[model samples]
Target: MFESVMWLIVVAGGPLLLALLMAYVLMTRRHRGPAERMESDRATKRLYSQDER
Candidate 1:
C-alpha cells in the first residue's frame, strides 16, 4: 500500500514539475530583450576575465 501511494505521487508530480520548469524557462526567455541579454553576457565575460592577472 505504501509503495503504491509513493508511485502515484511520483507519476503525478513528475509531469507537474516538468511543466512548471518549462513555463519558467519560456517566461524568462520572453522577458529578456536581445540588448539586455548581450549586456548580461558582456558583464559575465568581464567578471571571468583571465587576462586580469
Candidate 2:
C-alpha cells in the first residue's frame, strides 16, 4: 500500500514538475528586439572572448 501510494505520487509529480519547468523556461526565454539583441550580444561577448577559439 505504501509503495503504491509513493509510486502514484512519483508518477503524478514527475509530469507536474516537468510541465512547470517547461513553462518557466518558455516564459523566461529572451525576447527579440534591437535593444534586447544588443544586450544579449554584449553579454555573450563579455562571457566568451573572441580571441580564444
Off by over 4 Å in 2: 35-53
Q: Give each model's whole-structure lDDT.
A: 0.91, 0.93
lDDT of 2 by residue, 1-53 (tens): 99999999999999999999999999999779999999999989977886566
- In candidate 1, stretches whose alpha carbon ends up further than 4 angstroms from where it belongs are 30-53
lDDT of 1 at 31: 67
TM-score (C-alpha, index-matched) for candidate 1:
0.51
Give the C-alpha miss distance for residue 25 in model 2, angstroms. Answer: 0.6
Give the lowest summed-lDDT range of ten residues in model 1. 44-53
RMSD of 2: 3.9
TM-score of 2: 0.57
